[model samples]
Target: MKGLGPQIPTKAPPKQSPHFRLYARKYAKSNAWTLKVKNPEHSHDSIENIMVHPAFRKFNEQETSQTAQMSESLLMPRKIWAQLCSQRESDRPVILQYIYNQIKKVKKDKVQGRRPIDALIDTFKEENFVWSSERDA
Candidate 1:
């Protein structure tokens, strides 16, 4: 008589270990932890686990939206300014007027109360390009 051989049970593998589930739940409850604490923002998220811990879900959404908007506002102007400032002297005059215009626009849009001349002076000084009439002897 063939005995009730190999008991067959229908069940899926446990999705997560009990220890991991507990740790995840605890991690999702802490808020003051920095992004570098165990889970950085750039860390890869697994499909089996939630991408963002519960504590950071709302904050992450707000931060993402604000960052996108800020990037849009600063992207083009910053690129143009950086490119112009990095060019050689002989290649700069053509873009000088464009850079000057962008500086004015940034000041106006940001309401920073800085004059274009002052900004140009600061940029030149920061780049170590301040002009002097002294000639090499």
Candidate 2:
């Protein structure tokens, strides 16, 4: 039972970017089912684990009950999976390209920690996004 360093207040994530809302409306007829209960084909099991990485598990460590912690674990992974799935119905190819570029910067700078973006890029690749070297025209 010990307190960690100076506790920083956490902020709720902002609403989805305006672009996602507009994009969703355009694709709603086709992509709306992703908002349902089933796991979309794109979410690889290993990649989803990144959301619960040890670096982040502490955020849920103080949950008052096991149910709260369980829901916390399930909700974040599902939300991220659904967002990426729906994103694919639009310009996902371009988004994956953008994510690949960010990954390069992280590697070039020798970033010490495993960042959230790194996990995202890895998941995208696992979901079949080809890297530039292997990309086809």
Candidate 3:
């Protein structure tokens, strides 16, 4: 015989949990569901937080491998190129001035159609050189 009351079922799980009543009471209205809506789109974390796209990463790897395969000595650094350019710029005016002076020094009519070597020979007179005299002949 049980106690004074009628016998109830043995221990079994009821449908609801202890917290369900409090949760249901807090969110009772149908409009409550609309207030607590969920976003469908979710974002995941990247490997190291440096989100480089796969295509760019592949291209970079290919470029690095190709460069490695070639002779590394041929690759000029930025500082060297900059120095070369600056040197050229500095010397350009001096070279141009020298060329200008040389052009001005040249006689126009005397050497107009003649080659440079021929014109230079013509500059000296024939009297400058004397033939050896045979007894002052």
Tens digit of per-residue lDDT, candidate 2, span 88-126: 443222233323343344344543465756765766777
In model 3, the Cα lDDT at residue 30 comes to: 52
What is the per-residue lDDT of model 1 for residues 31-114, given as tens digits with 9 covering 90 to 100? 543332342333344656443344322223433343344444665645654544454343213233444454455456543577
For candidate 3, the 10 contiguous residues with the lowest summed lDDT are: 16-25
Best by TM-score: 1
Write down the lDDT of every candidate, Cα atoms only: 0.46, 0.42, 0.39
For residue 85, what is the lDDT in candidate 1?
48
Q: lDDT of model 1 at residue 42?
A: 39
For candidate 2, give the lDDT.
0.42
Best-matching candidate per lDDT:
1
Q: How accurate is candidate 3 locally (lDDT)?
A: 0.39
Clash number for each model: 0, 0, 0
lDDT ranking, high to low: 1, 2, 3
TM-score of each: 0.20, 0.17, 0.17
Two-way lDDT contest, 1 vs 2, winner: 1
